[model samples]
Target: MENARRTTLADVARAAGTTVPTVSKVLGGRSDVSAGTRTRVMRVVAELGYRGRAGRAVPPDAGRPPFVDLVLSGIEGTWANRALSGVERAAADAGVEVVVSVTRPPDDAWLTRLLARRLRGAVLALVDTTPDQLATLAAARMPVVLLDPVRQPPGTVPSVGAANWAGGRAAAEHLLALGHRRLGVLAGQRTHLYSQARVDGFRSAVTQAGLDLADDRVVHTDWRRAPSRARAAELLRGADGPTAVFACSDAIALGVYDAAAELGLRIPQDLSVVGFDDLPEAEWATPALTTVHQPIAEMGGAALRMLLRLGTDQPPEAPREELATRLVVRGSTAAAP
Candidate 1:
């Protein structure tokens, strides 16, 4: 007996007068489809006897795997590793798999790849989604959750992040408590929301403590070790250099360490230092960096859970979730000498 032809997603889409991704979304139980379109797709699916895979009749959950995509611009350091670990743990607990993708400025080809895979949802780490991309995902019924977004997303999009402002304030307050009146700040790029918030919070704390942070004391640099180190050396080599410095990130803090060494200054003795994002490298530093614990792993886990909720057609309690930040006092900071 001859084997019967199997119905495919493309065939269903053609019959429904829609695209493959739309049909995939309809079969995947995505909530982004309009009611009318969903109904039409369903009718077409039934009429076509569309078997999702392996020539089997379409099961309720047949179109896509029970997995979500964890997308990042780059995964080069401890921060990304910690986040990815958390996501993996959470996904395993939920009996779901995670697919990690590193894409810079995700384009239509990326979207096409995702649609082809029929991914359930996505967790974006420092990855900005454009309007066209968002619309495409919506049409395909794929949900997305942003974790530590570089830029603030639309109000409707759900996001999970650390309390950057509070973390900055805490860092400043720690330095102030140590009697460091002359403070220097290595701020990240102003275009990034988190970077701006951290800078604002540090300024607020400094101003409230009756100290002036001169423009010369605050230098904006790309959040990289090299640039940060260069800026730190410049700030420290000045005529009236600060006794204490707060770096916006641990990576930048590493720069501060290099700069201090180059200047023959001892950490916490001649130059107290603090950094944000208590990455593992912070603890391993010679003086164990005094830094803000931003809960990078927790943020990742939270973002994954939020995406799962979205995939289930459930609305999140809040559009934005800010995890708490705390100060981890280590050997790098001390009283002004």
Candidate 2:
């Protein structure tokens, strides 16, 4: 009775028009199935709500655990969560489970211990860890795909990152095109390669356009909400303030908005602002921020797929993927006052 009603391998086999042993092989995480058979079995398993795990090798039992484990460096903020959502969605479609963990201090020891367990592959969310930290993880011999990984080594590890430098240059050029010579840039932490690249690109654009970037015009702040607000306020209060501002991220741009409101300054009319990482909330900002849009969700999904492909000894399917970025002009930016 009740056991017969419950969905089982035999039921799935019947549903997919396959033999019991064939269904069992695919459900047991074997790669021997042809593409067509694997797809059929998975569709039936998903339809029947059959779940199996993947953290460790185990005899096939009802509802096995997930097979893939996901490692995340930082789990803070809406952006991180949204990106993880994309990865999780892809993993679920493949019948894989995802485990997310943060990489805290003493990076190597913590990472090594974490990776000692069985995992199909790993992904670093934003690559905030130090070079030494990356080297230690690479030595573990596990297939690793890094999102926004620094390009210092530029070796054969599958790296996926945004075209940040181009975005920064575009931001600067936009302000310049609007006749904004006195411009200020709100930069994120210098240690992060993404931030560094943005700063470099902005500086390069200023130089190329024959505009001077005064030392005081650029303010570097941690990618925190409060600190960016305070720093933006300090810069805005200066005697010779900028006519326009470029914030490295939307989070930092939010702080700038707060500071602007406190100072009774109007957007575009008084100061034009541009931001990076056109997050979902960017359009909803008070004046609707003008920003550089990065494909955060797509990047997450692609990184996960690349790692999964590494499960076998296949050739690199699309190594070193660099997604492009574009500038979205909106109410927040206008001709300098």
Most lDDT-accurate candidate:
1
Locate the minimum summed-lDDT window of 10 residues in model 2.
51-60
**Over the full model, what C-alpha lDDT does candidate 2 score relative to the true structure?**
0.75
The alpha-carbon deviation from the true structure for residue 182 of candidate 1, after best TM-score superposition, in angstroms, is 1.2
Worst 10 residues of 1 by lDDT: 51-60
Each model's TM-score?
0.79, 0.74
> TM-score of model 1 relative to the true fold?
0.79
Write one digit per residue (lDDT tens) for candidate 1, span 1-337.
9997776778878888899998776655556777667667766754664545432212227544486889887889888999999898988888788998887552324444555554667888887666545544544455788899888776657899999999999999999988999899998887888988998899899999988888888888988899889999998996579999999999999999999999999998999999999999999999999999999999999999888777423243437889999999999999999
The per-prediction CA RMSD against the true structure, in angstroms, equals 9.8, 14.9
> What tens-digit string does per-residue lDDT give for candidate 2 at 100-152?
87766543333544445456667777655554344333323345778877444
The true-versus-predicted C-alpha distance at residue 106 of model 1, in Å, is 7.5
In model 1, the runs with Cα more than 4 Å from the true position are 1-65, 105-109, 311-318
C-alpha RMSD between model 1 and the true structure: 9.8
